[model samples]
Target: MAERKPIESWLTDMDGVLIHEGTPIPGADAFIKRLRESGKPFLVLTNNSIYTPRDLQARLSRMGLDVPVDNIWTSALATAKFLDDQRPGGTAYVIGEAGLTTALHDIGYVLTDHEPDYVVLGETRTYSFEAMTKAVRLINGGARFICTNPDETGPSTEGPLPATGAVAALITKATGKKPYFAGKPNPLMMRTGLNAIGAHSETSAMIGDRMDTDVLAGLEAGMQTFLVLTGLTTVEDTEQFPYRPTRTVDSIADLVDLV
Candidate 1:
């Protein structure tokens, strides 16, 4: 135990951290309401950057959640921030969705045709052979590889789909280069959310359901972490990873007592 600090602000992971598949986990909605009632600030951070804040709001609303747009954060946004910081005037050749394109554009990066300076990889419901070939070609040339996250798969009602990590692997096989991931376990993602929300690192907590990316990222970012078992991570999985989280609970329902 790393002496869990007195918590204040909150940065929570979506998908598993806040809800499962699409429904609010057990008591997730009530947890958010409690936070609102207590006047505590929290942001819903997610590695799934296929959708923007607005898109997420609509989707979550369909699932009976009452989250607002401003309180959402995504790895797509973080990837954009990373590229903006590293290369100020590079054209981006992306293989993600509209939200990713929008994020990069918002960060002042130009979308290009060929031989772009950067290749930003994200989740795509429709990854075609042509898209893969283009990405491989760009990486084979001189473009830097940037990924939203390295998750090989994401959870779903049916199962997991090939996540950005699978795409990164293909590019690596083609170009023999690893992409810079901008999601959890990468301190940049935490910095992006915390900075955006103007939250102090010490007072903030990263609440998630996965151990590898979410909890590890929180520890690396110097934030208290809470891991819920409702997602991909398991207690047995923790036995393998050496980095322990601040605490583990069944679901967001337990947050009522801790936070």
Candidate 2:
């Protein structure tokens, strides 16, 4: 491979790349600090829409990572942006928590189940059957389907729990309509992040742990992709995918110098 341009901007997935189950990954803090000190633009990207940027910032602060609220981007924000651009001030029947709902409201979207333009799905701690039923009925009634991400399951100490994608499947089966996901694996999310930072793809890099979502999204978005092994994906897992990240490292610790 030819020598690459020096990285001027950075994007990274939050859960697996920076932290795991609420603990900071080794060198993750230093990596973030380096970005801040060097004045390089960066954003911590996450498919999770359960919390707002403030909530995520507080969580990270508790874990000793001082990521600013603006430096964090969630699927909820991306979905809201997508909706606002697609149809400004549109109405939706939202199946999500404060994060998703708040983002929509911020973008001047009204949340309602009555004759909504879209049925928005997002990550929540509890996915109530009644809510799912309502969502299915709404979609069947002519509301469009929109999901934050296509992750089938989310990680937890108890094990994997059904995520937005799993519930989306049920809604699809009942309503015969599929949702347009606005999270990783969809280059739209990556492009949105890049635009937010005013960064060029050629001089930017995306750091992620998953081959399916993070790496693929970055690659498709025209950004250099790096895979960190501290999370869900393994070195062997890369071979399963047709595309590959620009480089792989055992942990974020190994990539600190590159920053």
Question: Which candidate leads in TM-score?
Answer: 2
> In model 1, which regions exceed 4 Å deviation?
1-4
Clashing pairs for model 1 are: none
Evaluate residue 232 in candidate 1 and report its C-alpha lDDT on the 0 to 100 scale: 86
- RMSD to the native, candidate 2? 0.9
lDDT of 1 by residue, 134-193 (tens): 988888888888899989987767887888899789889988989989988798899888
- Candidate 2 TM-score to native: 0.98
- Give me the overall lDDT of model 2: 0.94
lDDT of each: 0.85, 0.94
